[model samples]
Target: MADQRVAIVTGGSGGIGRASAERLGADGFAVVVHYAGNRDRAVAAAGAVTGAGGRAVVAGGDVADETAMAAVFDLADSEFGGVDVLVHTAGIMPLAPVVDLDLDTFDRVQRTNVRGTFVVDQLAARRLRPGGAIVNFSTSVTRLQMPGYAAYAASKGAVESLTLILARELRGRDITVNAVAPGPTATPLFLDGKSQQLIDQIASANPLGRLGTPTDIAETVAFLAGPGRWVNGQVLYVNGGAA
Candidate 1:
């Protein structure tokens, strides 16, 4: 129906991105599942939305490519009437200490995380209906200051800044902008290089004593996207008090 809300979830192929997409779908938003290179994974995400009787479709492109991402937003408008929410979760994490991190890798991470966010946020800022929301992804590493996370942390730091500034820039537009900074979550992005011992150490450091699941983060995204009307220009630390 024309009045049904639509959400475009970037990085919907896996992890927290997919979980947020699923949760929003369950909440009755028509979803545009956007992926960069994983069509099969994205297809399954869309299928989960459909399988559970929610409306969904898949759109694929490089999130940093303005033209490509513009097309993704266009597809959402064509398919779902208009966009009401944007969950920008497409990003990369390349771990290395500041001294050892390759400049090229750092550039790539920023290109995807920072620039991709700019491209998508620009589009959403232009097209999202009033009363919409934009949720950007960040990492608690920005606060944790963990070693081997210099490049990744820097990128997310940019995300947090952009989210806050944009929220203020959209004054009177009725669109809420916020970033979700998650602590050591068990997604592939967080667990890829850590040993079980290291993982356990990080988990135990949290007062809650465990790694965050995607659902934990998704619930926050859902709240900000839907009923959390007053939560504007904020960075929600969705960790279990690790930071």
Candidate 2:
């Protein structure tokens, strides 16, 4: 594994993060599959990586906790030697209109989505090797202005801004920092409270006429993590034209 690349995929327990962890592993990355709380799912993700003839390990932490996340990067160093990519997909999404959203809920969303991103990105920025990539997650709803998504959208807007400044901040380090703003997708996060009719309506509104699959977003994460070198500081909307 001397010449192998290593990827630390946050939120690897499920959804787009799980798909991305497996994809990067298939692409020959030694992976650190990170989870917030789900050990079983994270182990399965690591299994997928190793089953594909790649090296992998499981790490768990709250992304906003510096000590917790630092341990995760240390695991990468100890187990895989070094880190080359950070696909930061760990986040919380709760939908509430601005008026109805409580201060506690708003603050919690900010802490997890905004501060969590900052913490992980900070670790990635410091620890990643030259030519490494940092991919953060955003949402197309920031532009679509969907009702009941104010808290989430505001958080992602911060992510987009952070992605840009961090890319410039890492100038000449040969690291690429970008954000993936996925549109309406079929992940549990996206499907959890909506009705079938609303889901169908969203699918129909997309030019592709379907909800995006987790693998669809994962493919783009793989690209940004690897060969998409020229894509720094940009937010790629992976919404099938829904935005």
Per-residue alpha-carbon lDDT of candidate 1 for residues 175-241, written as tens digits (9 for 90 to 100): 9999999988889888997799999998888899899999999999999999999999999999999
lDDT by residue (157-177, candidate 2, tens digit) is 999999999999999999999
How many clashes in candidate 1? 0
lDDT of each: 0.94, 0.94
Pull out the clashing pairs in model 2: none
RMSD of each: 0.7, 0.7
Error of 2 at 84 (Å): 0.4
Weakest 10 consecutive residues of candidate 2 by summed lDDT = 47-56
